[model samples]
Target: NVDKAWDPIRIACHVYIALHAEKNEIVVEAETDDDCTTALGRIRVTLFHAEANERTCRARYIVEPPPASYMRKEVIGVEVESAEIAKDRLDRRVKLAGPWLTQKEKEDWEQKRKELMASNEKVFADHLGSAFINLCALNSSMRMRVQFGNIILKRYRTEMAKPGFAFDKFVNMMGQSRTGADFEKMVGGIELGFKLIHKIHQSPDMFCPLDNMTGKLSDIKPKQKLIYRKCGNVSFRLEADIDITVRGGEYQLGENSLYKEDSALKKRLDVEFLAFNSKFDWALEIMTQERLSSNSIAIQATAQDLLSSATVEQDVMDFPYPTLGPKRRLNGKDTANIHTIFQYKLMGTPYVVQILLARGICSDVVGYCGASMYSTNWDDHMGPNEGEICERWKLGSDLRVLFPLPPSTKQSSFATGGQVVDKHEGFRAFLAAVDKVQTFLSEAVSEK
Candidate 1:
């Protein structure tokens, strides 16, 4: 929708091409050759010329009813997670805490049970601390990935009724796993597994579509173009990037605690008011009429005008994307980006979110902390089948802010910046604003 709406020219084209089994909607047994490059292993292909089915002179109805023999209709992306959580860890902790909480009903529970049950937070914290006791993670680190699939999108709540217990409820963390497919499901789609214990519903996944997104993106990319133009490479790229970081990372948290800097710590507590700034920078390229068009990998315009980089990157792939040199490279000379930095507290927090003006179709998480890159050629990708220019694009996807959402900013000049358990208006306002951005993006996707 975004692509066609932006520039119909970049939509799918027709050409002779072969797609792998995964894409062909065909099932095949294959072995992996770790030592080999390019792909896992080559499988035999039973080619059937389109002329054999229904002949056509040029590309006609190429983008629709995908070459029946090529693509399949099977769901492509993530699915809603249904695996039941393994309560063993949680149960064990419960047992240690006393199974009476469960054995006895609300009216029959014992005094200890009542006392312990009085504070699920205290119980969770106690068990969490115990769990960490055996954990060999000191200078160690823990990580979990969240991606768009059959996941749920939700807003944050001010008061968390529970301690985000179920200690090991997340599929990969403490949740149960299936037999064969466990390995490939590295990142758990947002499930009712482990979470902020508060906003357990919001999955930490990032999705980039040709246009705006409503939430889950499992059905967007492939369905958009049932049959793709094989010969003509339809590529996309992004140009802008914004980084989002929450306040309580190992470094800052450690720094604060180590120095006992109450004032410094209070200003950058876990709870925060969300704020970011987005800017766009763009330029134009003018060239010959011949250069304005080509039969090359067309880039689909994204959120056409809402964001310059989105559309510009798409323009680079197809017609009129002008080039100046003897090679007649992309003439569309300018690119733009969006810069967003959330203001945590009156100062800042570790929860950092980066909004980059990316242009193409790519998937990635937030860049690793302190990551750096050095590249040489950056234009080769712009050239045709074979180009002299060598360029590389590195992008990252959603890194959902996993920190517990505290209804609002926890600002203080001194004293312990404990959790905010009273009001939710601040957090609600934050989510509302964030949603407005989504609405704005959706508007961008819809406008062009």
Candidate 2:
């Protein structure tokens, strides 16, 4: 098909690699006409390997023209060069998050990485809080926490939207027995479940992730990786599950209002971290208790349960029995007689998100409100593989500011704060009137 003047110097080459086999082919064509449609010589190249598959090994080949008088088909020569292994090749894939640490921080992290790799047992960080001191800076931690929180919310919303959706399925996966029917009654009713409720500053901008998230997270931010080692970057994952059950025993809305003394609350939290590069894993369980004084009261827990002393506590500084630490937000005056209950379980969700970055991978009871910790090994309670840290923590304005209160109630300061509407307000008013009259009659008799 030659259409142009012969040009032996010009050669075109293409290579094709077979997916299912180790064989690769390289084609060489020499143009011989001006039409660019004719080739005077064609040579086919085939590669053969002694022990390598298509998945690994690098290859190089060479081709030469045959003598003019001795040609018996085109001569193609192949040479085997040293092949590079897969692990040694340059890796050019997307990384989650890294290259954010300073030089000194990277060096420090490397030393720690070496230590962790050398140890057979896991390194435990009991009260894993968002302490800006950890390798993951405070700003980075917050960004990632908000991102992960949004993911959980999105997944929840998607699943709930489907037909025959049940919240109990998620709870059960987290190892709980409560069903969807039970969850609806705890927060008043299905309509009231997950209502907008805020605490602390109650500013919508500062607290809620749902409204603030611009888009999905491409990669979990504030991720860490050891500079000296080949192990992959250390990333974070977050999950939130909730269950609302009646206190002491299950009760209907109107049937047991008078007989019930309080609504006992509980938080069953499980935190775990697995370090593949370090070859270790750490995990722990947390159980918390609280109570709402009565129905119709928006905010209802004790000060110890509402503030920092509930989840993050200082054993030496706070009262001994409560064993609480400093408050994340709010003062004594702010929490005084404030109702801690809300239409939705908004308050607890943020804490679950923040605590993931609190410390290293450890199983301890440090960042939970009125919580107790349990472990398989009793000796490891206080340290790695051990016992509980046992400190109380209060929810702060930063976590509460996301939820804005409805316009109907503006007289209150905190979103959760409001006037109580007792179910038997009229009866209680009548009883007060009768008590005043009886007191006046007794005073008159004494005077006579």
Candidate 3:
């Protein structure tokens, strides 16, 4: 479908110029037959006459066959005219036949040549060099001009075929360059690094506990060790349960359980203080230094707390504890009295007990105690007691007198037969106590 005739004409013109244009000058002209339907055109080229005077010739060309060409049939008649025959055509033809440059032609060529050279020199000087660099000057309107300025410079270097160039070093230099805006670029890299570190640190598989144990007994296995995948720019510590078997016993016991139990008791003394230092260390590394925000810390803490709480619940289910109060006393007085003083009056009272219970310490006892604490105080306050106020007074007290007394008890009568509180109700009460503490802190902080 492509027309090939035009290709040869183009090639012939190029060849004529290359061969004869010593000074690299081109001259174009056209000629036509009688009907003007067929036209022939040629280009005369001349090269620099460095050794010759302005009037003398250095190199010239009347292209072979004069670089002849004809126009297509359709437009030829409308656009072209026939060659004149009145003049001494044969004589003129003979004189111009050899495709050589004459003295006068050479003089005229030299004059025009000087003008063109001057113009080109002026343009090159005005641009200060290649047009490409000028196009990328600092004030360009294009947005990409700024964003990709370094990229363009790098590409130019590659085009020039420079060897041993390091793109990362180049990019770093550009990011810190004094010539243009760079804060965004530098921050962009920092942000990317932060995200990558966080993702690697947070992935569960990064700190997997590899073991050969499988099947139903895997959960009860005695020996389990943790292995961490290699990570860069970050450090981690395992705070998880590890089960180790005793030499004489067939059973594998949770080594972490003892630690968790002791830690839990310490938690009662001050839950916030128990892991204070470690938590702060993690926050400093993962948040401030690593650029993760405080919100990330809160999320991780919530997840850990939820998981630990669930594990504690499972442990309690596996091993039940004894009920509170004397079993033989049957007037319901012993249970009622314990419930009134402990459950209602001192259940969630802060500093009453410095020891934290591992498996709810006394799960049944605490529930009864909390109920008694609430009941005794309910009539006096006519509302829920402030949990936060109590916790603050307890935890934030002087070191010498860390323990505080619970609310004073008042005598209250209860029916001989009354509905026993359900487990769900007890849990709800516990959560209420926790919520009151949280709510008070929230309000206090807001006021500040």
Q: Which candidate ranks first by TM-score, i.e. highest?
A: 1
| CA lDDT scores, all candidates in order | 0.21, 0.22, 0.21
| All candidates in order of TM-score, best leading | 1, 2, 3
List ranges where model 1 is wrong by over 4 Å: 1-139, 142-430
Report the lDDT tens digits of candidate 1 across residue range 1-448: 2122212211222111233445654232213323121121221111111111121111110011112222122211122233332222211111011122233333333443344333432332333233222211111111211111111112112111133422112212211112011111112221111121112113223222223334333232110100111221222223222112212321010100011112211111011111111111011110001111222222223222222221111121121111112232232432222221111111122122212121112212211111001111111222222222121111011111222244335464124666444333332333333433333332332332
Q: Write the per-residue lDDT of candidate 3 for residues 1-448, one digit (tens) a residue.
A: 1123223434544322122246654323224232122112322111111111121111110011111121111100011111321122221111111233456655655565456445533432222122212221111111110010000111112211222333223323322323121011111122232232233223333211122112221122121222111122332222223222223322122222101112111111000100110101000000001111122343234223322222212112132222223222322111111101100111334311011111121123232101001222212211123432333232112211121222332122222364332212322333234334323222322332
- Model 2 residue 406 CA deviation in Å: 32
Give the range where candidate 2 is weakest over 10 consecutive residues by summed lDDT.
Answer: 145-154
lDDT of 3 at 204: 30
Clashes of each: 52, 39, 15
lDDT of 1 at 238: 31
lDDT of residue 179 for candidate 3: 17
In candidate 2, stretches whose alpha carbon ends up further than 4 angstroms from where it belongs are 1-209, 215-290, 295-352, 355-448
> What lDDT does candidate 3 reach at residue 47?
13
Tens digits of per-residue lDDT for model 2, 112-198 = 545543331111121222111221111111111111000011112233333333322332322222211100001121121112121
Q: Which runs of model 3 end up more than 4 angstroms from their true locations?
A: 1-237, 240-423
